[model samples]
Target: MKYLIFGSKGQLAQEFINFFEKSSIQYKPLSKEELDVRDLDKVVNVVKEYKPDVIINCSAYNQVDRAQSFPEEAFSVNTLGVSNLGITCKEFKIFLVHYSTDYVFDGTKQDFYTEEDLPNPLNKYGESKLLGEFFIKNTLENYLIFRVSWVYGKGKQNFLYKLNQWAAANSMLKIAVDEFSVPTSTRTIVEITLKALKQGLTGLYHLTNSGYASRYEWSKEYLKLKQVDKLIYPAYQSDFNLPAKRPKWSVMSNQKISKILNTDIPLWNEELKLMVREMDI
Candidate 1:
C-alpha cells in the first residue's frame, strides 16, 4: 500500500522507516518542516499530491508538563492539527493510523484499561490528545487508534534513555513508586502496526509490553540489566513537584492488539534488555 508518514524525525516515525527500509512498499516521509498538520491547506495539499492509501501521524505535542503552561500549542498540534488531518483523510478516502496515550483515562481503574473505558483526562495534555482521538473517530470510517504507554527506543528521547543518562550521572536517584505503566518499545509499536495493516484491522487497540512497572521498579531492572550500580530510592510522585499531574496507574491492557498478533507481547524487561543491547547501554 502507498503510505505517508507525518513527523519523520519522531521516534515512531523513525521506527516505521526502519521497518519499511528494505521493503517494496512506496512511502513518502515528511518532517514538521515538510508538512505541518496545523496548516490545513498544506495538509490537504500534501495528501492530494501523494494520494496515499494510508497516512500514519506520528506528530503530537507530547510535553506533558509544559502543556500546562502552553495549552494553545498543545491543542494546536494535538487537537486542531489532527482535525485537519482527519478531515483531509476523510475527503481523500485514506486510512488514518493515529497514536494515542494511556493518559486519556484517569489512572483510577484497578484493572488494565480496555478500549471500552471512557476517557476522563486529568491534565491538559491528556485533554488535548483525547480531543484528537474524538476528531478522528468522528471524521474517518477507516482508522486505527493505538493507545500506548512509556514508549522507548533508539534515535529519540524516551523513558529508558533518560533513566540511563540520569543513572550514569548520579550516585543516587529517586523515582516514583506509585505511577505504573508498560514501558513499550517503539519497535513493538511498529511491528504491531505492520501486522495490523496487513490484517486490515481498524478500530481502537492498546499496544504495549505484556507487563507493567512503576518508575522505581523499571529503573532498578534497567540498572540491573545494564549492570549499572546506583543508589536508587522509591519516592512519591508528588516529591518531584512537577507542573502537571500524572496518573498513578496508566497501564493499559494489550489483549486487543495481542489477539491480532496471535501471541502475547514480550515482557517489558525482555524488550528493555534487547533495546539496551542494540544501544550497548
Candidate 2:
C-alpha cells in the first residue's frame, strides 16, 4: 500500500519511516514546512498527486504548558489541522491514522482507563486533542485513532531526552510522584499500527505499553539505566507549578489493542531499556 506521512521529523514519524524503509514499503513523508495539514487545498492537491492509500498524521501542537496561554494556536494545529486532514481523507477515500493523548481524561478514575471512558480534559491541550479526535471520528469512517501516553523515541521532544538534558544541567532533580501514565515507545506504536492496518482494523483504541509508572519511578529507572549519577527526589505535581493542569493518573488500558493484535505488549521499563540500549548510552 502507498503511504503518506506528515510530521516527518517527529519521533513517531521517524519510527514509521524507519519501519517503512526496512520493509521496503512505498511512502512519502512531508515535513510541516512542506505541507501543513491545515491547508485543505494543499493537502487535497497532494493527495490527488500522490494517490496514497494511507495517510499517517504525526503532526501535532505538543506544547502542553504554552497551550494554556495560547489556546488558539493549539486548537489551530491539533483541531483544525486534523479536521482538514480528515476531510481530505474522506474526499479521496484514503485511510487516515492519527495519534491522540491520554490527557483526554481528567485522571479521576483509580483504575486503567478503557475506550468506553468519558473524556473530561483539564487543560486546553487535552481539549484540543480531544476535539481533534472528534473531528476525525465525525469526518471519516476509515480512520485509526490511537490514544498514546508519555511517548518517547529518537526525537528530542520526549521525556527521556528532557531527562538527559536536565541531568546534564543539574546535580539534583525533583520529579512528580502524583502524575502517572505509561511511557510508550514510538517503535511499539509504529509496529502495532502497521499490523492493525494490515488486518483492516479501523476505529479508536488506547495504545500504550503494558504497564504504567509515575514520573518519579520512570525517572529513577531511566537515570539508573543510563548510568547517570544524580540526586533525585519525589514530589507532588503541584511542586513544579507548571502552567497547565495535568492529570494525576492517565494510565490507559492496552487490553483492547493487545487482544486485537493477539499479543502482550512489552512493559514500559522493558521498552525503555531497549530504547536506551539502542541509544548505546
C-alpha lDDT of all candidate models, in order: 0.90, 0.94
TM-score of every prediction relative to native: 0.97, 0.99
Clashing pairs in 1: none
Clashing pairs in 2: none
Predicted model with the maximum TM-score: 2
Q: Tens-digit lDDT track for model 1 on 1-281?
A: 89999999988898888878878679999999988999999999988888999999999989999998889999999999999999999898999999999999889999999888888989999999999999999998899999989888776468777887787788999999999989989988998888898899998999999889999999999889888899888899999999989989888999877987697689999988898888564
C-alpha RMSD of each candidate structure in angstroms: 1.2, 0.8
Scored by lDDT, the top model is 2
| Distance from true location, Cα of 263 in model 1, Å | 2.6
Give lDDT for model 1: 0.90
Against the correct fold, how does model 2 do in TM-score? 0.99
Candidate 1: where are CA atoms >4 Å away?
Answer: 279-281
